[model samples]
Target chain A: MTKTITLLLHRGPYESEYADLAVNFALKAREKGYNVNLWLYGDGVWTPHVKNEKDYPNVGEHLRKALKDGVNVKICSRCAEARDVVKDDIIEGIPMVGLFDFTDWLDNSDKVLTFMR
Target chain B: MKTLIEIFRNTPPGNACLILTKNVLSVVYGESFDDKIDEKMDITTKDFEVQLHPFPSKIAEENGIEGAPSIYINRKLKIYGVISPEEIKGLIEKAKPVKIGIIITKTPNANEDVENILAIGEEALKVGNQVELFLISDGVWVGKRGNTLTEKRLLNLINDGCKVKASRMHLKACGLNKEKLVDGVTISDEPYEDLVDLVMEQWGKVVIF
Candidate 1:
């Protein structure tokens, strides 16, 4: 049976290494042939709000790569609203979800990691 | 303080109804005034012509509100206080063999987070749920011998059969090692891998700080 790993990212991008690590971990886990999920909570909602610029080592780019590589990603809708990050401000295809949705991921995951401050 | 909302909601003559919140009443009628309302906010619906009247606090006292935050549906007291969020979540979740994973990444003594974690960890174990704690980053400081408040609480969980592990790499970075850790605290050679195994295979739920 294939194992699933869920990563909950609670920090914003650029300000710290936490978000980048989570994205990197997700990519690495995916490379290992595991099903991966990325749940962006709290300040983590700022992660996908970035439309990455060229030539910069942006965490958003890594997140987009992970998303393209079959990583299921979600952002907290309430957190996004608090930061004034609308649906159009975030990366395409990622969903703005609720707190309970993270629990749903937790309930289904075999293993989970929380990347935060 | 909490406020309870209730609608008298009679037969209504048919299908029309009106709703007024406390906030709206304060804005219109002013918080201090008590006036006999001869005119009503009238609206005609398919069924009934409804009259909406915002009642006063004095009338609420007449409705058997001996204490505040009490609701009166129709001359009868309903909710007296508030229902906690935990109670609601518990109602949604079933009792099962749940393995709880806790990851601590901050220094303790600055806050009672470790104490809270100890309480939760003990309760989980008491209820026959498996509990695991991973001490990483500055969390390695929690594994020290004399952790003040953190040590006593952490040792309690360790003695209670909770699996407590510290990140060896973080311990080294923080100038701490296995020898300086609590008696039963184990050091993970590869914290990330162990964390993955803990979350991915060993545990069903996780709480990270």
Candidate 2:
């Protein structure tokens, strides 16, 4: 049976390396056929901002790909408000929820992973 | 059944007892030791099914062991439990292994510090050791994506199968975005007290950075 893995992300883009790693892990896990859920909490919610940079790989793009591949990408509503992130400002396909939802996902999951910066 | 009876007689009815005597001094002795003495005492008194005995000084006593902060099972001291000389070895081997808890806090020197801690964790993993790593306080900053050495090292460690955790409350306090963190990191809703209890229960050794 496939295992459900929950990833609690707590970092932001251009601040440290966590965003990149989270994307990579999601991609790899999807490739391996595991059910992966990526939860954006705290500062990690800002990761989906569409970057205008020329050289860097887009975090939002990575998330979109994961979503296309069946990964559940979510952001914390409380975190977004605390960080001044508006609903419309979020990337496509990702929903803003609360800690309770994250907890529920975790309780129903087989494994939980954390990525912090 | 005979072996079980012998074990029951030698062991004090619970899990093996572990003594971590690390660099702690009795004041009167004017000396320091590097083991988990209090932890050992607690385990000895607890109502668990199996026992884990920790002997931190069997090395300095030169009984021919090489690591400090080491564990001695059945009078045999080893660095990472590598030596045994008798049939009792099998019994000692049957004892439950210790869990290790590692916490990395973000600081002004967050980048380099997380990298170093991850390197240490990788080494532990190489030895077939399992550990739980928690990122709390400013340490949550290490979870940020892009332009940091610590981030890269942390991702590598996660890929290599390290259990990574972070404090959810701390992240909110710092206004850090959970989406920006690396994949495979779990946010802990449990309080710091719970974290401490869990670590104490699982790990024989707890290292903080």
Candidate 3:
């Protein structure tokens, strides 16, 4: 049966390979015909704001790919605002959801994987 | 009897530090000393990993009780001072492994994260804690054909009821065939996303390395 998998990413982009692993897992889930959700919390709200320039592993690009695969990508508003990430600073199509959204997802999701650094 | 120094040096993380000051001091200096010492030292932080012991009188010799207000990290002397709660918190965090999901993405090499995970996971098991390890990305190599001590330990962990798994895609990515995998690994047919969810649903904490 198809499962609704929630990837709760708690690490920021570029600082480590966690964001990449999160996106990779989401993509792999999508490939297997599962519903995926990427909920960014803690330092992870910094993911969309990461600059995608040059040889650096593009966290934005991977997140964009996950979105393309129909994964619901969201960021914690409070966390983002704490890091000075205004709505305009985030990647297009990504929404700044509230902390309640994560709680709701946690209750509804069939599974949850947290990528904590 | 283990010295307070040894206890402090050997104290595991997430465990509380016990400081035994003389009861005589509590009588002479007034209970205010206990109150002051306890107030000044708060071990439990945002997460409840480490705790502060409010000077219990029992088990005095276990604490190497030589003097009043003797500070013990795992029952060892930590010298008298305004103990840095942050430092104690850090030590507690480092020494303890909570019931959690540990994902290994890096290939096993000399002194790699997998070895640490295995050691910590094994220790947790000894203490009757649960540790679920997922081998994804290059970490699938641990499940692939190999008879190294590390790989053998992976199998032993599985046989011992440890939840160890390898991603089929990752195994394939590493050019490993499923038939070649060491026994006792759950090769998920659901893909990486499901595996992530599976681990998370079961564990309150996740550590990726």
Candidate 4:
């Protein structure tokens, strides 16, 4: 049976390699026939707003690819607000949700991969 | 100073005992506590068939019983002083075989942490306990086929009966072939979530490395 996985991203894009690695894992999980859910919280909410700059792996572009590959992405609403990431400033497909939904996803998911700074 | 959990888990089930009341309560509340234990045991002891041996306080003291309501599971001392019925039941359940699930996400070069976890799993397997490993993230990088010392360690763990797996997506993303994984690693067709569920449902402990 297809198993569900939640990739919990808790780090920002710039300071560490956590966002790049987590996105890579999420993409890989999707390619492997797993239902992948990406929940952005804490500093991770900054990932969706990251612009592809010179000399760096474009985290936003990779997240877009993950979204295109059918990965379900959600951003923690409070975290997004705390980081000043309004709706239009974020990626198009990823929705802003609450921690309760994240908790619910945690309970129902078969696996959770956490990336922290 | 060992807690009941430590004593019960450290010793095998049938070979363990627990002594309660190594304090002034042994004199003041011993009789009442024993009576309560007897009453509770009548209804609750059916599942485990654990026998309770009661002796005169004099004989108990002779055996170095420092407390009241001493409990012996298989003949070894498991605890000392003050326990509830619910706690005893929990300890009994803990006496069974320990099931462990380990997830390795860091790379092999990341402080050699993967080797440590593999060693732990191997040790558990050597003692006839159950241990499983799931590799994800950069952890999948270790699945590459090679004769390196770390790879050999991983292969040794598999030879010792450890169930090793890697995330399918990680494998594909890293361009690793399932057929080429070091002699016994499986790239699960199911999602990473399922692997987590399988571990949590089947194992008694889950540790992420």
Candidate 5:
């Protein structure tokens, strides 16, 4: 069975180290042959709001690196709804899921890392 | 005993602070009954003692508060931001674990990440679990000896048998060495290996800050 790592992020881009570090960890875990699940909760749902950036760092773009490498990503629907985050507000192809979805990921994960404030 | 709930909010008041405060009150005590009276003064359940800790407050500073609307339950359990009533209930009812691995990745005093980390470690110890910590990035600064609040908490955790390891690379990057660190903080060369092993094999849960 392929080992899976669940990275639960609770912070958004430029807000703290979690967003940037979560992306970096996700990509590295993928490269190391681990299945990575990026679960965005709280302010983490806002990470996908930013697009391309020339001068500043856009974690979404860096997150794309992990996504392109088959890293699974999900955002909490409750958090999204509370923050008024619609499907269009986030990167395409990622699903907004319920908090219960995290329970399933937790059970399926070999390791769960919560990246919080 | 009234359940003491400490709510932390940093400099520059946040909407979440107010919202969380509102939600917590409403959760414990339903919305105001009197329609003519706008402000809800009714207390359905008066078991909770809520303390709002705005930034720069003496008690908050003494508590090593890291605000982003952080909440501490009875000065023990902590959760970031607001949570559902069900979730808060679950946190209170949570059980013990065999091992807990905590990673602190930020420099201390810049914020209260150290407080959160140390508190968790101490609680894990109190619960009779093996607690281990890895300090990476600028977080290695926490290993340095100091007379500050953060250091006191770290020392308490260490004295309580919580194992702490500092990243050698980060310690060097910050121009620090074994002599500069506190007595109990371990500065090992191959902590990444230990961290990986602990996260993958030993720890049932890993909380990174």
Candidate 6:
């Protein structure tokens, strides 16, 4: 069975090295045949919003590809509330859930990696 | 005691013992092997034993040891095993050649953190160095009870002769009850400042996790 790797993104995409490293790791893990899940927390909730802008390469596009390739993307509800992000504003394919749900996902995972900035 | 002797006695027949050498034979001899092994060996064998080993760095790379002054017994890292009390004693005897300091944050969230530090400290102590843990900030709450991870780890460290201290101001800020802290843990009125001074005063390398 493929191992599950949970990446906890705790910072906004642009401000921290965590997002880039996490995306890179997720893509690499997918290529390596591991099941990957990315949980966006704290400022990480802004990741899907900046996905497909004119100047931006669209992180959400990569996330979408990751999803298509079988990666699960989740954003924390508390973090979204703190950031004033509405559910409608969330990009399609990314689900927003509570911290407890995220913890359950982590507990069920084979490996958990936390990216804090 | 028999199991302890067998484990420490010059690497068993089928088991491969990887030894790391640093600062010449003196430091490695001082910290890596149990003192009982040294006491058991004849003077000629002791001299020969020290001379036979290569540099620690080379040995580490050759044996896939990740860090300096580490040992791998039975292809498993020694740190991951269920080490017995006797084995622990042997480790302490061998590890006294160096000095290591550990710092833990004393807070409600620090229970797990302190436990890990204690585990690492036990390993360090087994390697023969004096190990000291300084708890500061909210980390002083490591002494708080309710069967926390920190309490379990602290218990192990205490058994292994690791010194644990908590800061006074942090304790007051957290409103910690003095009786609730784990036994054998020293509570100081100025633990944080004392910890800082100790960090500055001693230890060649300081590891905080």
Leading candidate by DockQ? 1
Candidate that would win on lDDT: 5
Off by over 4 Å in 5: A55-58, A81-89, B1-97, B106-116, B119-129, B150-162, B167-179, B183-197
Winner by DockQ between candidate 6 and candidate 5: 5
Pairs of residues clashing in candidate 1:
A110-B200, A111-B199, A111-B200, A112-B199
What DockQ class does candidate 1 belong to?
acceptable
Ranking by TM-score: 5, 1, 4, 3, 2, 6
Q: Is candidate 2 or candidate 6 better by lDDT?
A: 2
C-alpha DockQ of every model: 0.25, 0.02, 0.24, 0.12, 0.24, 0.02
lDDT of 6 by residue, B19-78 (tens): 222212223345554534443232233422232222244544555544322334322234
Q: For each candidate, what is the lDDT?
A: 0.69, 0.60, 0.65, 0.67, 0.75, 0.59
Rank candidates, lDDT, best first: 5, 1, 4, 3, 2, 6
Tens digit of per-residue lDDT, candidate 5, span B84-195: 7667656545522357888888887787767777888887787457788889777888888873766777787888888889989779978999998888999868655555
Give one digit per residue, the lDDT tens place, for model 4 in B88-158: 55654554446678877777876768778778887777544678888876788777788374688888778
Clashes of each: 4, 62, 5, 18, 0, 15
In model 1, the runs with Cα more than 4 Å from the true position are A14-21, A48-65, A75-117, B1-98
Better of 2 and 5 by lDDT: 5
Candidate 2, TM-score vs. the true structure? 0.45
Model 3, residue B197: displacement in angstroms?
Answer: 9.9
lDDT of 4 by residue, A59-113 (tens): 9999999999999999999988887899888778888988998998889888676
CAPRI accuracy category, model 2: incorrect
**CAPRI quality level assigned to candidate 5 from its DockQ score:** acceptable
- Give the alpha carbon lDDT tens digit for every residue of A56-97 in model 5: 767888887778899999999999999999998777878898
TM-score of chain B of 5: 0.53
